[model samples]
Target: MPAPLIWLGAACLGLYASNKANVAYLKHHDIVDAMPGESDQKSIPVNGSIVTCGIYGVLDHTGIWYENTIYELSGKGLVRCVSPERFLGNRSGTHIYVACKPNNKVLANCLAANRARKQLFTLLDYHLFDQNCHRFVAEMLVNHEVAVTSFSDLNTFLSEFFDVPIKWNRALVKK
Candidate 1:
């Protein structure tokens, strides 16, 4: 066999091996799997009735959902409000894990305040390790006296500090 052909075969094998390893790592870390037609909408509370606060992502990305809108500080240095259909849609490969659903009045007030403080709410301030999307969500929830620590600390914080039930929903990945 030609040397170049042998090297090409080896490279293909290496790529396949690395891909499998990546999938295993993601699963070990509890990253939600992407199945066909999966969706997060089922877990979302009825609009204007309950505020479902939670994070949605696999391993590489994550965002927050409040009421009907999903908010996240994108890597582009902006806080974006994505529609539920876009956020949890099959195109994004994101999932929803409801940490807590607070009272309707409380959620309404939070949403109102979130709208009123537009400057603070949609600021283009993004820090990956210190002040990322998770931090933004945690701050907003904490300000409303709803306990949440950070993106990675979600389940533990919600379980220990709040009485609201937690729910999970997996969104589909676009093929």
Candidate 2:
């Protein structure tokens, strides 16, 4: 084995360890699930604003549930309303976060209009780092003044910076 190979192996192991630690932290905090359906779905208010955030595998996906429809950007590069069950079935160990705020009629209308517009449902130029599911959710929420602009900032807001209420299933530990 060459010296370079040893370094590469070490780097890979480090990355793996870091990911494991992050996952563990999330689990311990009761923010993520270890398996599918491990967490229960939180109820969305009928007259308030809500954003449903999900983590599917390594991908963090999010959507807004409005009028009983879940709007999200599909892998096919289109924004569409999908059934909650279908969305959850896409991946195991999915974690959902909901943020609810008062008087979000404007945001609700915007989402409804976007869903109705065929033009907005076109191909999405998905970029993993620059433009992804998280970005999409952030954009929608920010436009409605429900969330901060930056995704990193929003994470902080979700965890600490905001007075808005959030709901999620309790983390379950397997025996």
lDDT of 1 by residue, 1-175 (tens): 6999999879767856664565455335544232112333343333221122222222224445444666655656677766656654543443443332322111212543363235334565565666655555555545543333343344334323444422333322222
Q: What is the TM-score (0 to 1) of candidate 1?
A: 0.46
Local distance difference test values of all predictions, in order? 0.42, 0.47
Instruction: Assess the local accuracy of residue 174 in candidate 1 as a C-alpha lDDT between 0 and 100.
Output: 25
| Runs of candidate 1 exceeding 4 Å displacement | 1-41, 46-67, 88-97, 100-121, 144-150, 170-175
- Deviation in Å, model 2, residue 96 alpha carbon: 4.4
lDDT of 2 by residue, 1-175 (tens): 5999999779767856665676566556644333223334433333223344444333345565655556776766677776566556566535444443222211233543353333246677766555555555655644433434233334434444234322333222111
**Model 2 lDDT, residue 150, Cα:** 32
RMSD to truth, every model? 9.1, 7.9
Model number with the top lDDT: 2
Cα-lDDT of candidate 2 = 0.47
